[model samples]
Target: MPAINQQSEPVIEIRELVTYYGERKILDGINLTVESGEIMVVMGGSGSGKSTLLRHLLSLNRPAAGNIRLFGQEVNKLSSRALHQMRQRIGVSFQGGALFNSLNVEENVAFPLREHTRLDDNTIRIMARMKLEVVNLAGFEKLMPSQLSGGMIKRAALARAIVMDPKLLFFDEPSAGLDPVVSADLDELILRLRDAMGVTIVVVTHELESAFRIADRITVLDKGKILITGTTQEVKESDNPRVQNLLNRRTEDIPVNADEYLQRLTDDLAGL
Candidate 1:
């Protein structure tokens, strides 16, 4: 990734963000900033609210409190039309590729341009092929998603994600199910995307190696709170026990109060 201009405003900003599911808090008072042309990796274990944060950032789920600003506009304050327009400037490559099974690689990549732009079919096909080439999937455009390998599926999906040339790109678990070599290739592609396109990137994953490999800065989340946000070296040298435990993959034995545990069990039974 390239060095960002520190004088400019962040492309993505979250301020004291809070979210919940029923009575259980999912994200609590979170704050972070993603600068232009940077790759920010958000990593945590399951139930640590990393995915929830991504959902909120994508504007799929509204926060219970606080605010999210993308491109200098508060997301929650935008009207439906305005929000849709805002989304046009953003792109997301979902976990599982999220490519339509019915669509071939070319059609899958062209879907966004066809839906979002007024480009003619010939132009859309050309643009889709261009993005496919960027991801190194040029000659396989006619193949169905089912025909592609796991890495190819990911690359094809990435091509679709960048087809519109979004200002901000969100990647969900880009290395979740790949072999080591494939995972590293994906990581390199991510770095290239940020460096070549100068697009701000946010990657949500539990893959520690991938996070460390691609992040310009990393934000580690635990139980809905930010543990630390820093450069890879700073995170590696963190003295905070919780952060260290996460990095070392050490399980912490958290003592539970009997009363609180009983109350939680009683509450669950009552709800059931």
Candidate 2:
């Protein structure tokens, strides 16, 4: 397939992004930028708030204080209609593929077009099949989600994501359940999509090897704060101990308050 050949632009811009779930801060003062055609990976350990960060970026959760602009328009201030219009310019490939179990691959891929466009059924089918071809799943378009292999499911979801020909794409845990070989293949596919479609890609994954292989830059988060946003080599050679601990898989020593732990386990329900 031929490339989209678009000019460079800033697709995602965030400044001082702060998020909270009740009283606990999930993302603290995050500042980030993803230029067109870049593959920026967000990596963190469990509870490091990587998933929370993704949710905010996707506008699923409101942040306590921050500015987020996609395609030069501020997202937080947009109205319902404006937000929907803005979102149509981007696509998301969920962590689990999220293909409808009831729908075949082609229908799942075409669903977005059907909902968003005035196009006829044949046009939607042709477009969906074209994307399927792009993902190398052309012949399997009629197969049900349950019938496809793990990798095929991922590729199919990807085909759906790009069927809209979005300028930005977000992937959540793209390699989460796949084997090493399959994960590597998916990584290459991500790179190809970026190069061929010129889409700015943001991937949220905890897999270190895959992050190193596919990322143009990586943002590492710990305890709801950004450790560093740098190239693969820069991040790999980071001097921050937290970054080193995450990279080396070493355990971090977090001091626990005995009183707080006791309170959590023993809620004073006796008074009630």
Candidate 3:
């Protein structure tokens, strides 16, 4: 089979990346790239280092080894000023929405602008409202985070994340804590954003249904290593046992030994 080259130039690249937390290795020899406008889902079991990889991509955490480049610029080599400039071109919707309790939707959305730019309050408000409209929360700008449903909170956070009109968007488990219908809606929103804004999206998620629905390509991580990287179809057809079990939801058919089970139960009962 011919190799699938998804893009002409990758927007985010990680080559042989390794990460450590004190004495423990968090990510091991990670190599992956996300192309411009591509929805690349990083799928993994809990503690599989998917979030660690995302942090590395955003330069929130430095790699212990190898290289990470964003928009063709080495992340570690960038000066602090340049790094901030690079971050301005990217939007991040963190898990749990991460909105402030004190700030209403509009104020929360405008927070980035207030901190990063010289835009006047009026302009920030307009921009914030525009972004809210994009996420289908146009008239709810005055509502508190507590008043919104889980889905609405996520959408509002998304609006805030994109207020800067970023070229790259990172979503950390966009569908976490959401019901199936709401999760699917968020997937559709991700699709629309990519199509409309030409933004490269990196989603860190383990939800099989959501990942398969939204991802153009997916990378599976296990034991601090990448198990596979392929399109949804390709991954579904993967011959690796672990991949097959994951995609097919096939459980290991372990047969219980009758003698051992009887001995354990009977011994416990006798002692009782």
Candidate 4:
């Protein structure tokens, strides 16, 4: 990936972002910035709050604390109508593709246009096909999602995501459940999308190879806290033990306090 202009205002800015589910803290004081036309990959183990962070970025959940600014607007401060308008500038490609099983590929891609714009049917069809062509799925639009292969489904979902020509694109595990060849192809497609469309992209994944392949910069999170954010090489050379453990696939030996453990068990039994 090429270097982006550092002086440009970031398309996505997060500061001290905190989220909670009941009494459990899912995201703890996160701070991140994503520059225009850059591909930022966020990676972490399960329960590391990566998913929660995505939810906050998408404005699907209100953070317990801190601010998320998208295209210079604070998401949490927006009214429902304003929020919907803001969302029009953003696109999400879900991990499972999330296409309507009953709808064919063309219909799925046209859904956004029909809901958001009053474009005529012919215009919508042409625009949707153009987007599908961009994703290399031009002729497959007539097929249902179930009739396509895994790779095709992902490509179709990506077509729908980009059909609106959003300024920011969010991808969840683009390479998951695909073979190495298909995964590499998807990675290349991601790079091409950034280069051709100049859309800022945020990818959430745990796959190291995929992250390293597509990311201009990478942010690693551990236990609800960010461990490091840097170029891929910088992250690979990080001296942090947790980062090393994650990259090397080593398990951390977390020592337990016997008294605290026993007391917690006792408390559970007493409550029961």
* Whole-model lDDT, model 1: 0.93
lDDT of 1 at 234: 89
**Model 1 Cα lDDT, one tens digit per residue, 74-177:** 99999999999988889899999999999999999999889988989899999999999999998998999999999999999999989989999999999999
Per-residue lDDT of model 2, residues 82-146, tens digit only? 99998888899999999999999999999999999999999999999999988889899789999
Work out the TM-score per prediction.
0.95, 0.92, 0.88, 0.96
Please say which candidate is ahead in TM-score: 2 or 4: 4
Would you list the rank order by lDDT, best first? 4, 1, 2, 3
lDDT of each: 0.93, 0.91, 0.89, 0.93
Looking at candidate 2, the ten consecutive residues that score lowest on lDDT are 1-10
- Clash number for candidate 3: 0
Candidate 1 at 201: error in angstroms? 0.4
Compute the lDDT of residue 100 as modeled in candidate 3. Answer: 92
Cand. 4 TM to true fold: 0.96
- Candidate 3 lDDT by residue in tens digits, 62-163: 888999989999999999999999999999998999899999999999999999999998999999999998889999999999999999999999998998
Instruction: For candidate 1, report its TM-score.
Output: 0.95
Q: Which prediction has more favorable lDDT, 1 or 2?
A: 1
Q: Output the number of the TM-score-best candidate.
A: 4
lDDT of 3: 0.89
**Which portions of model 2 show Cα errors greater than 4 Å?**
1-9, 256-272
Candidate 3 ranges beyond 4 A from true positions: 1-8, 250-272
